[model samples]
Target: MIAGREVAGFSDREIADLLAPLRPAAPDSTENATRRDAFADAVWSCLVEPGDATAGVLRLALGPAAALVALDESDAVVERRLTDAGVPDPSRLGLAAARARWAPRAVEGRLRGAFRSARVMGVRLVVAGDPEWPGGLSDLGAHGPAALWVRGDPGVLVSGPSVALVGCRAASAYGEQVAAELADGLVSRGFAVHSGGAYGIDGMAHRAALAAEGTTAAVMAGGVDRLYPAGHHDLLSRVAARGAVVSELPCGTSPSRWRFLQRNRILAALTAATVVVEAGHRSGALNTAGHAAALGRPLGVVPGPVTSPASAGCHRLLRDGGAVCVTSADDVRQLVMPTLDLGGDAGPLRLPPEQLRVLDALSSRRPRDEAAIAASSGLSAERVAGVLAVLELDGRAVEGEGGWLRGRG
Candidate 1:
């Protein structure tokens, strides 16, 4: 029993029915244990929010079923169980705080409702050991999702090589065009595209990949049962028909701002690389890029006109040496398959080390005189002047009345 309700009330027959979509061919001998574990994971998906490291630790230490039972035990017993399971420091985990956050949603009705909604919507719950699970997600460690709610062929998620194309929701025409071209080109080379199911660049990528008849998955912030951005209903439906629409949350969960931010981590972890096609200085896509870099996944960006604010984030990434400049599908392919040489250069701008330092010192919004540029870039004045001249000839920088700024190329 848990949260004033008897666990026995949720019959094994009902649990098996709810999981039928994912367990079509399970052997009878192992079905009981499999059903119990899957049901526990489903309950865990409801008890904690996305990317809850504490919950992840608990689930890993106790296993989903034993962890759920721990919620009903006294704090001392729970801590002992954690210790017995080899947790490094059980007290530091703040079980009391975790329980406080989880208590409100621990009702049996909530669990039943989630399962009911999933069964009605034909959503499949996929736990970590499932064959359909994406192996790449293991890289997230304790911050990864405990289970996934999927609405299409879960096989598409584990299919071949995948790249994430993410950017600002309010993308410009040029941004959308480049996103489509990259998506189409990557698909033709046998790569699945992944993106958030949002408007602008994400929409363009999904549409282009589908037009090329390639697999593409939309990782949503909300429940797989409720596709957010209502306008993309038909598009998302089409994606679920051919690929998958996925979320870490269970059915009936609504999308929130925090959930959207947490959702970006999953997108970064699920693919070999992430590309920021277009982003403003404050675009949320930068959040995804940060995750990719932290995970040691290759990050790529598409450069836009220097004067366009829409490309400011991409420029920032390049200038900071946080991402590689990739303008074509071949360049992206190289990122995923580093050893597969494509003959000559893939056409990314390969500036000299000194020139790149000078470019990094130049500001897009504020002009800096040669002495100031030299000081910031840690280069000699003579070298700075020469590099500035070469940059000017290449339309990479422009001198104004007082100083030089990044060019409008």
Candidate 2:
């Protein structure tokens, strides 16, 4: 039982129905254990708000089932359990504060309702261990989502390389045109496009990608079933038919101001890079850029006319050296996959075999000494040093205080 509700018969039936679409053909003897964990994760999705680090820590220290059980136990027992699970200082995790925050939303009836709604809507529950879960999300650590409620093909979330194109909802004509061109060119180059599924730049991006016959995913601020911004209901439906429409919240939850900001983090984490097509000084697209930079993902911005207020935020990013200036799909591609060629009329940006190996060995987050890079790329220190100099000049790599690191390009 979970949250004082029995997990047998009715509850089990609903969970099984919701997860049926994602289950593998090969049956396992531990089916009951899998069901229990899935149920616990589903309940966790409803109990905590998006990006709750304390809850993330709890879920990490104890498995979802054990974590849920700890909620009803005494504080002393909970602390002891956390200690046993290798937490150095359980009190530092703010267990009291988390418990207070979660108490009001711990209704078992609501939990069951979310499951039924998902089942009826054909939404599948995807947890951390699932094959369909995107690997990039692990970077968010404890602040990552507990689970994802997906309304379309879960596999699309992990498909190939993807870039997020975002901007203000009230985009200008110039901004929309730029977004559409970028999306079309990116999809033609074999990249999937991701966006917020909003009206302006986001809508243009999704539509262009679809028109080009490429996969595109929309990360929603509300529940997949709610499909906020009702005007884009048909657009989101088309995206779901071809790709995926996903959220961290359970079914029936409405989009709130805070939730929209939290949703930006998922968009940043899900893609290899984030490109702000156009944004005002306070546009929410800038919020997504911040999250991408924080995650060590490459951030690109399209520069608009200096006189245009719609692009003030983008110009700020460029002037501050926080993001690379990307005017075309080729530029955005280099930001995410620096090793790939630009192809087409621009010709391929080819590198020597040795240089390519060393470039591949470079880390974007950690700086590596020449010797370490040499060892990884199977090259001598002398050859590595020479290649590093060329890469640095090309803006494909940088020499940091620690050693060498991948550049944003």
Candidate 3:
């Protein structure tokens, strides 16, 4: 059989069966993928497939890249190794490094259900080279996902107006309060709230997003099939039922040391903006913050009591000029969507670096072409458009015969 044989001839389920035992033990990581044994034969079947392409999908579907990531290899290094081993560059890491890695894991019915949940939650997939792949992830560089397995209304990833809320696992009252409130407000105002499904701040954010009846996504550390921090399984399931719970791994693969670090890159890459509610100096939340700032995505740090250790990291980020200080959900709202401010209820004035440029470009000039806007604002076209779209929708700017100009209304 050539690489063109229909996969229908070979059940993916069967390949998945063979791959199950290939799982290299994690660093005592999430073990959800190890719970069953029915998916091993499928792995062998996939490896021995008649065609190269079908055989390739078998590996992509199994996510061996994730196992390599767990071994501390960068996506670039991993891609090279795969290619050297004759593994085709599938997606996410077609060339550049992708963040998510799929260590060997089990294939489970629950994960199959996650595929169904994309439809159930109204989310859609953004394959590696898909036109709709959000450019924001370019910030992740070699640490982005090989492909984003998404859930939520389709196109939400690339379209606009999404922000992430992340923080400490041992959240304080203030941290939880801030997270829930901000999540609710952002959702109510039509922004998608993305977060890890950990306890403390992440959980509060997801719950608040749901309560506000807004779209939310959970970027998991493990495969979407297995919920990490198992206590939140119900919460995660509810989210999968309504929104998307994404992962970079194969359905049954668990998250390991390298996987979690890479997963943080996914959380950072997926959103145009990232807000850190509370974290300690060594906090993993800080990892997400690092990716956000490095990628030049809007980075925010919510203020907390000066005395709290949780707030220590946020304060450090602000002091280092690493992030803007955010007091309320409104601040996050502005940093991610500056042009679309609603004055009355609009709480604070923390603008992303891009918004400040648009304001500067609006001097007594009649209007400006996008190129001039980029030159004047010192922001990239993609960055400015992301900001401008929010501004236009918020009635802050108008597209006239002349061009994009500041609007009085």
Candidate 4:
């Protein structure tokens, strides 16, 4: 075993006392959480950041307890075990590098301090074996959390189907309104609302869920004890009281940019589907939508005015067929609920009314000259010429010896 892992690992008595909050409050309630599982998972959670698939693979190959013991092994031993476990590493150097990252955080004191802080802050830990762990998160494969540091009822994570409402931080009023209404509607019908508790659309969604007396889970980038955006402290506290404020990080860990990006995956994974209310061409919410798509979770986007830059990302998703256009809660429901029609095409293609009138002037069966078609369609000759050219390019109009007519089906 490596130098300190044997001495640095938490003892059973220490772990049992530190993780008592994770156990069921009811005397007769059945839950399998134990000191060994909670402590090892907590050690791993602090050892790696969110979405560390390497840690996940290790924990799975040798259960969390054995994995903790193995972390103290030589780099060669860990590497060989990883290789035998079928983790891809053409160079066989990934485990060695991961050792460098994990070594500094493998101390038992730091692990104990995290649990102690959580106890003082009323935070609870939940591991994968717990019944309260959201099953939807298993879809993350090797990127699933090592353990969850949560405030509020963990049961909320497992209860009912959930929808993620995420978008830009500087969302427009229209975006916020749409997000709130969507949350309200989904919650009224028994869906829990989920989002990162950011300012604009995310805050709107959470507040709406609360207003509707529905549960909402906020997956934080920082530790649950250290709520990042001070502005939303009260809101998040309410969520923790009524629902959940959860993270993979231990107490005292602050938020970072990379952590924020990685955090999007949990928001995507914990829900049945994701809806991006409004986002810029480069919004982080697009990252969440991408994760959802990668997980095969249904992704929906609300359309914005053609002029709004805030909605550009959503429009891009629709145009690229990365998301289905969803305008209402009903549209979102169709994504997760069964016995619903495959939704219709997205927002209408913006076309000039005069162009439609001009196109209408030409029949698929008959053809007419520009002047005649212009007179029939109540358009000037110049307008008719431009419209016909555009229509022809779009395969909506065809020109022949007779003149112009609608294209064939």
Candidate 5:
């Protein structure tokens, strides 16, 4: 049996067996990993807390397996290894402090037990460099997760452009409705919806995406082996079926306030754009919006009633010029796919308020009667007729066998 270094008393064979189910299948590489590398990564995942920059620096320098071996060495040896690897000693904590923080937690049995529990629950780990890992996560640098605990199609995590729709947990009815409609519209337009899978707006986004048969990922604060908030268990299970339920923490790790704050970075990193559907003055969704903005990702916010306190955060984002105002999925698409020309016109298609409202009521698929259009647009029949005529002349509206509908222009 191969001797244990990080995981004392455990044989290499035992470590390999525990980690086999969680290893990512490489898409292009021909070489297989030695058992030690995989096990060391797993140990590193649970050894340090999430977003530990010092640990990230060491792993980047000495590599994960060697870093584990260096854990037991003297400060002189560790500093030499750091020098040889060209990694500067961390500023936040010295080598001794870092070792103190990591060594006590790197237990052999703890790693084994967590791996076994995850395997039993169908949870798997996707480390960095795995084909299934999201390439966007690399943008986070040292703050990124060491490995992801996933429960779903790992491909969906990075398959296409992802939009994160997040908002307050104690959401208002108006907020929930907007979140659901935005999620449904985004999915219809081929964007995967991502959320924290909490209550209120987050829950609404996930449910709407699943109802529309679109993919949605839930970036959880805790481990994938157990669902948090207890009530969202059923909803998140559906998310895992269609997209993914992912966490940076290992199995058996519980959610904390700090973890929730850190989890926001993953939601931002996984998506091309982040939209805050609704938020109060100090909502957690704003934290996510901050991360998105810091990453230079496009930020969007849905405008709510001026008087509603729940929308205070969104209004703040808009006023601060930190986010663009997005009213519909079309607006969202423009933020992500900026190169696509939505309206086929020589110049910007500026329309009167009534014409714009009527056009919004019209559908691209089925035709609607004049009366239906009038009711939907909240306009009088005479005004509707007048606007329809103006739109039709501009090649923006069409009359079909049924009645009237949207045009190709």
Candidate 6:
């Protein structure tokens, strides 16, 4: 159902296992001699499949296919972009049924036309053999994207143990603080921060990781290059510069509320654990937490003051036995750090006040100018600029053509 079509019998996890081998060879990965032999075998299998839409989708998704093509007006309601490679034509059966009502050339024309700009676009297609692919998401199986249009770096996907922190987009000030503090503590302990890249807690996680000069991952509902919520463009650009912004959706695609629903699944599955800093009763962050529970991933909720509506969902999670309450970064790391065994105990982590001042000027999703940093942190432009230089040297901040942003180290 996640592919916008039905695939009976096989669970998503089973499907993820089937495609697990294809990750290293992401969409843009180059084909080699061994790969050629495999491709030949896969396509032939697709072409020879007994006539059926379910088999058609499986064939396109697995091998002997380059894309699944569907005709549509805009990128959002993708009619199809099914890539099925075969020694014989795989489209004959499906096209035959639909063509009786439409034109055969029109069907073929649609596939060819979509492929035209798609090549220039370099739609990310992670073959089973690509490097830099994240196998964690393969757990989603048929529900996962046929291939991800990854922006930033694929290395970040599997670079280290990651913890996703999500919350309400309309987060309270304390919620934002928890998000930032959680991110800071996570990075300090050596876990890469991951989130949906939304406003509120998600944005704060990215910004905090940058402030800490630690790696962070931003998962998107749309194309990585497009950067939805256009307001976060600058913050996202910083993420791309420092860590990565990944998307299961292809480039040129736009986000929808429906897509956002599934996007949380990808976010939840990709990390060692998930932490909800704040959320209202219906916040998407809570949805993400539910996905984590269903997927059997560890779920943590940050406790907030009793009065805030933003923390209500978290309180509910605690009440329902859905999540464990985490009051500090130590609580989070104790639950998820063993997978990578970061050994954060080698020494005490430290950050100078000068660095903190610079970081104080940054937001989880907002950038600040030298003057702004000075005013907010109560330091002189000269003083703030000097501290920025020191922070950059320390790998805590970065200077760019646009301005300084929390560096994603």
Q: Residue 268 deviation, candidate 3, in Å? A: 1.0
Model 5 alpha-carbon miss at residue 204, Å: 0.5
lDDT tens digits, residues 1-409, model 4?
2123232344555555666765545233333334465567777888898887767888887677667655557766776776787767724446667778888887767877787888888887888877788876787877889889889888899887899999999999999999999999988777899999999999999999999999899999999988869999999999999999999899988999989998999998888789999999999999999888776576889999999999999999887653667898887876554223335433223245465556545655667789987775667899989989988887778899999877742
Task: Write the candidate numbers in order of decreasing TM-score.
Answer: 2, 1, 5, 4, 6, 3
Per-residue lDDT of candidate 6, residues 55-172 (tens digit): 3344345442222222212222222333323224434435434323323323333433332333444333343344665766655553544445455566787777789999999998
* Candidate with maximal TM-score: 2
**lDDT, candidate 2, residue 256?**
93
Tens digit of lDDT per residue, candidate 5, span 99-163? Answer: 78987777767877788888888887787777778977887887788788898888888777789
Residue 202 local lDDT, model 5: 97
Q: Show the colliding residue pairs in model 5.
A: none
* Candidate 2 TM-score versus the reference: 0.83
For model 3, residues 245-304, the per-residue Cα lDDT tens digits are 876554445667666776787788788689999998888999988877656567888888
> What lDDT does the true structure give each of the candidates?
0.84, 0.84, 0.62, 0.80, 0.80, 0.63
Greater-lDDT candidate between 2 and 5:
2
Score candidate 5 by TM-score against the native: 0.79
Off by over 4 Å in 3: 1-126, 129-133, 151-159, 344-409
Please give the lDDT score at residue 320 for candidate 3.
66
Candidate RMSDs in Å, in order, are 9.1, 6.6, 11.6, 12.6, 12.9, 18.7
Query: Residue 90 of candidate 4: its Cα lDDT?
Result: 22
TM-scores of the candidates in the order shown: 0.81, 0.83, 0.59, 0.79, 0.79, 0.61
lDDT of 2 by residue, 148-267 (tens): 999888889988889999999999999999999999999988789999999899999999999999999999999999987899999999998999999999998999989999999999
The weakest ten consecutive residues by lDDT in model 1 span: 1-10
Residue-wise C-alpha lDDT for candidate 1, range 1-409, written one tens digit per residue: 3332223246666667666755554555655666777777888889899988888888888877667766778778989998999988888888889889998988878877888888788877788888888887888888999899999888888888899999999999999999999999999877899999899999999999999999999999999999988999999999999999999998899999999999999999998789999999999899999888766577889999999999999999988764768899988986665435466444334356577667656766778899988876678999999999998997878999879987854
